[model samples]
Target: MTPHATYPATQFRIARPTHQLDAVVAFYTEGLGLPLLYRFEAHAGYRGAMIGLPGVGHHLEFTEHDDGAPCPAPSKDNLLVLYFPGRQELDVISRRLEDHGVRPVAPENPYWEKKGLTFEDPDGWRVVLFEGSFGGGGRST
Candidate 1:
């Protein structure tokens, strides 16, 4: 769908503040294997990184203010769910995450426990690597 036809925006960004900027960037970039699209330092006393697949119309922005950015995750249930085509695709990424010292955790929701692997990032935010299309006729939980 066109940007104007959707939410009146051309792109989408999920922005969050964290004290562990370096670790957070590494988790998404190195562990998850997402490309770092952009990075900035000392911009109005904030340093940040944007990471996601290029040309995907959406990306994640993580920022840290010079003063202090101790934004802890509010809940274990809040997650960033990434749906892969199948287990093979998800396993490939899972291996990389494991190689980087990331491990899957039991999801707070039992539905996810049956659907995919859930991992907590450095900032205590959860990420679920689901092995199916999100809105397609993949599998029921």
Candidate 2:
């Protein structure tokens, strides 16, 4: 057999401008259930926080951009998609988000062979919770 190779994404980070860092933190930590990994004062009168997820080799870093620099508008350009191991986990996550008053943009269901839910962060960053393989007989174009 030939030698095998593996590639995995380590982490994801984004700089978000917000007038309410505390509220953002609460939304990400308490609302989304991601653990606050780190927080620090950034340059030019700003702050940031890194949130970690269990089992996934990825973490989300939120940075506060310079004040009065025109808070970046939300878009569908880039999104942060998270995958769970199964449907039960997906349901639990969706319920938690709802309990925290975060309405999911797209509720959970089996689509493209996976059960999942979709929503946007306070800063308009797209977040998703999916479970299943997007391969084999069922795939989306």
Candidate 3:
């Protein structure tokens, strides 16, 4: 089968359920320096936040069910990789995460160890801050 030359997804979000909504939001906003774009509370027994770089086409959504969100990270290798263009950004984010009491964890793969630093969120999901840009600058062409 062949792929479509151009698919049509105007915006994107990676959503996850978390029990610790506050810590999760802090991880993305304070630790990673992403802005909180939108948030809601007690809507259908849920509370959540969307965080990312403003004007970017994608963001992360973390939600909690009032009943209890027992979702856990599937594995250490499951990661949301963010590509950065320089080491300065990496250093700044690293310091911020450290100040927030979030320390980098060793990655499961050696390739990531060589190219980036990894950290786990409050719910154990891993996120990577790569030291260089991804193909086509991490944006869809």
The candidate that wins on TM-score is 1
What's the ranking of the predictions by lDDT, best on top? 1, 3, 2
What are the runs in model 1 whose C-alpha is more than 4 Å off? 1-6, 136-141
Q: How would you encode candidate 1's per-residue C-alpha lDDT over 67-119 as one tens digit per residue?
A: 99768565989999998888899999899999999999999988887659999
Q: Per-prediction TM-score, please?
A: 0.90, 0.70, 0.89
Pairs with backbone N, CA or C atoms under 3 Å apart (clashes), candidate 1: none
CA error at residue 17 for candidate 3, angstroms: 0.2
Name the better of 2 and 3 by TM-score.
Answer: 3
| Highest lDDT model number | 1
Q: What lDDT does candidate 3 reach at residue 121?
A: 87
How high is the lDDT of residue 110 in model 2?
34
Per-residue lDDT tens digits of candidate 2, residues 1-141? 423234344555655667667777887888778899889896677688878777665676666765644657666535566667788987888888899888867433334234566777776666777685545355622
State how far residue 131 of model 2 sits from its true place (Å): 1.6
* C-alpha RMSD for every candidate: 2.7, 4.5, 3.5
**For candidate 3, lDDT tens digit of each residue in 80-128?**
9887778898888989999999999999886887768999988888988
Number of clashes recorded per candidate: 0, 0, 0
